[model samples]
Target chain A: MKSLIVVMALSIATLVGLVCMRVQATQSGKNQESAVSQSTISSDSNSELAQGAPANPQTSSDSGRSLVLVASLTVFVLSVFVGFEIIAKVPPTLHTPLMSGSNAISGITVVGAIIAAGYKETGIGSFFGMVAIVLAMINVVGGFLVTHRMLLMFKKR
Target chain B: MNALVPLLYLVASVLFIVGLKVMSLPRTAVRGNLLGALGMLLAILTTIFDRGVTGYLFIAIGLIAGTVIGTLMAKNVAMTAMPQMVGMLNGLGGGASVLVAFSDLLNTSDHHVDTLIAVGLSGLIGAVTFWGSLVAYAKLEEWPQFKKPHSLPSQQLINAGLVGLNCLFIAILAFSHNSAIQIACYLGIAISGSFLGVFLVNPIGGADMPVVISLMNSYSGIAGAATGFVIDNNALIIAGALVGASGIILTQIMCKAMNRSLSNVLFGVMAGGGSAGNVDEIYANVRSTSPDDIAMILDGAQRVVFVPGYGMAVAQAQHAVRELSKVLEARGAVVEYAIHPVAGRMPGHMNVLLAEADVSYDKLKEMDEINPTLDSVDVAIVIGANDVVNPSARTDPKSPIAGMPIIDVDKCRTVIVIKRSLSPGFAGIPNPLFAMPNTLMYYADGQQAVLDIVKAVKAL
Candidate 1:
């Protein structure tokens, strides 16, 4: 009984903290806005943005690029962590519904990649862009197909 | 900054891919969203470094305004209204992405015809998804449209023509005497999208909106990601892709649960004579139970399964329901929760509220798992959910819900329904479960009624 009380108290505190974090983000945005001025802006406004942006110098620009490249690769690899977590915890019955719905959103990635490819100027860029489009297409087509299968659950016949 | 673009895009693409994959499952979809968000955050941070903070003050204000509205919408929106909220937000995402692409095109003076065409296409699509999704949202929320079963096939034809015409605008804008064509395309996008929104939602009944909402959410995410390409932003692309994929999967699942297709759920929408008033007229129902009778039902139960829905949420009966459950459990009866996927306004809505009332997560069982136990349970107490526990889904093939997955509360020995009135559910179908011989109807406000049940159980 005592433990239940403690848990209840903790849950309330967690809810409050989440709400506060949300409020704080809003407040911070407001504060930042009042700090800016319209008169000080220039034609090459991108320059101003770049100036104050992440001043921590990329330790050896070449190495920095390599580090970002490595980080990007690691990010993709971490998706496996996501994979393991979902399949293990999800109840078997909900698998059909959840998968079909999310698959539709996956279709958007293909559409995005297609537009990106269409805009590319170079042969290599276009080739990679085409690859992006194809991957996105696969996601879109596959998602729709899966969704169609799930709809069979509701069929009258 | 330029060198990082490729790597950043690669990471964004990966997040987009994985996020969609994870969204297919209810359990991990939330985690999938968080992971996709992290990838987008990385993309956003990278983009900001190279971005010229053009009119930084306005940008800041816009961001602040968007955040405030978005947060309020997220926190306060009811689960029942979740589908509508999803539709509105999706529309906003698509609209904003199109706006971003348009701004980019307008800022640059150089006439790269290919780039112009791409931006135009992106803008047109973004606008269409935005306005169209809004109408879809309105329909889900039951925005007071008087004409029932409204249909407009011509609107669809116009929409198709408008999209093609917008592409033509790009080609003309590339070598036109003035920028009128581009402006006209924007106008057409706004009009067509708005019209399409009405047409899409006009025929749709309230019942199938959860599925449509999920689908619209996917459209919104895809629009945002596609727009990201126009602006060459890695983060937006990743975030948009994640949201889009997950939305699709969720929509598919909802359709399956409803026994409908994405297309059917959207376009095969129907609004017929409301089943509630007509049923009440058809069968002169008699009140067979009082508060005392309800107390007796509670007194005799050895096991109970409580099913809650939007009506419970509307009643704000989480606290009272928890107390009632506790009282029943103390009476040496095993109590469990039957959580239907589409029970409340949104996914896990009842669970979240129940959790808020300090209900143990272990007590909640998904519908399929709980349905089997219903037959063995002495009593099933349905707080406010109607369609979820309806026997029609199981016994009658001609019923509106027919093959849609439902909790087998009809199998229970005794059933009690506490509701405001005999209002039909979002499915717009009458619940025969309410009229079953074994079931007792005690219509009142859910919160007060649950509290009464608690007191009755305590007296027992």
Candidate 2:
């Protein structure tokens, strides 16, 4: 019962955070558009308008980036709920495999690492990215294979 | 093609969820794992076509090298070393997150508040998980320096200070305009977070490893999710959240089984520090029995159950126990294993060991499942297990392990305990079960005792 309360509290907190971020993104989007339009028509403040006009694209992208954040947060929270519902049903016998299997899933960071490595933006960044790729892949491959090996051993008469 | 990539990622996320769902059942678990791997492969392949990913040579090299190393580790690890293996893998995953977050922070020109915060979180949590898991792995592997729980008088204070330092670093990183200063703050967060992790996990006792490992697993997942937010990838977010939730559930289960709270385990509070009854007084009536005597008891026993613990793993007696079970079955006796949730170093540790020895999964019953039926069993053979079967948990309210859920092995008609000595369990409390009138002690190594019992039963 206490654990249930903790879970509910966590869910509520995550939802609230995501909702706030979504609202912030929408507001920022509106603000950026109004700023762009206002700067365009205010010809008397030419210097200010010139400086602000150049940053319009960047501000617009910032809002766009926030939208992406909102989307990702939505996915994260929903997947957490799905995880709770699905994982709760797993019996004790499979707990170890569940842990190792999920450990493999966390290796999804490898996707981010791959992009980082292949972007070639900075020499140090690529170096770290390549190392991250190796580490994440080890987690992916090792975690899954070990779990599979353990699962295969569970035979019934 | 670009649209198809997101669609593929969506498909991969769904596959991961479906795979975890399928893993709930034993029969479909193997297929479920394969499906997860398939999803992973799909996600990786799809990422290769991502725009701006031009350095294919490095990616190929990393993939090949990682695969070779991962496969060898997976193939060569013994079942007994599973906890260590999982810990090591968790550390690698976390370490990877730290690197990815650092790389992204360095490469991206966009210093958005949200992105910087996410980057800070990814670095902090990832570094903590990596360092903490390495400590856990070393403890499990029984490194001499870490074999015993190490604690200082100001351990918690030190840990709190580190956490404060990390948070300060993260905040500076988030609001800082200078990239160089931002990078330094990020490094500060990682370094402080690493020390925080080490300090937090260092003092925890060996018996609390299951909870610690589960918590570390959750941290790794959360770190991955933070990295996902940094990279703005839904696939990573989804997968990381699933793992995070799964680890939380497992940690909750472990804590419940031990009747301890998460905080209790984390703060290194020894379970039930209440004054236990005197050791000599508790074991005064303890009766000793030999293998022949145990065999004679088993000869006429109609129902028998074996309770195993970490000591069984130490003795490597799983195969011997299986042999004994087979012999008992041939003699028309029922044999089943009563598995306690926190029995070995990790959750489900004993079950994996028994599975490796070809024991049928059906014969393994959970603590709750077998407790009610223990009264009807003719004999309960406790092979190296102690605390789980201790009657004090139920009878002695003042005992250290009071209120903890334990197998009611003492309720059986006859109880046979195979152990080397009367030493206390990880809880360091004397067990009154050893002194019960119906309980008989068979003093020997777990494997030797089981093998002797098999030989004696055959001779009978």
TM per prediction: 0.68, 0.91
lDDT of 2 by residue, B203-295 (tens): 888889999999999999999999988876667887899999999999999999888899988885685443435666668789999999999
* Interface RMSD score of candidate 2: 6.6
Tens-place lDDT digits, model 1, residues A13-110: 32333333234334434223212210011223323222433112213233433333333223222322333333334453334334433433433433
Candidate 2 wrongly placed segments (more than 4 Å): A1-57, B271-277
Q: For residues B1-460, could you state the per-residue lDDT of candidate 1 as single tens digits? A: 3234445545655664555455445445555544544554444344333233332333333334444554455456543354454456556556555555554443333323434554665566666676666766666555677225477666557656765666566566545423445546655654555555556656666555566566666676666655644544344444454555555656666677667777776656543333566587533653556666777887878888888876787788878888888877777778888888776544444554565566776687988777767788888888878877777777777776777788888789988888778777776677777777788888889888888777766776
Docking class of 1: incorrect
Clashing pairs in 2: none
User: Which candidate's TM-score is highest?
Assistant: 2
Worst 10 residues of 2 chain B by lDDT: B271-280
How accurate locally is residue B4 in candidate 2, as Cα lDDT from 0 to 100? 56
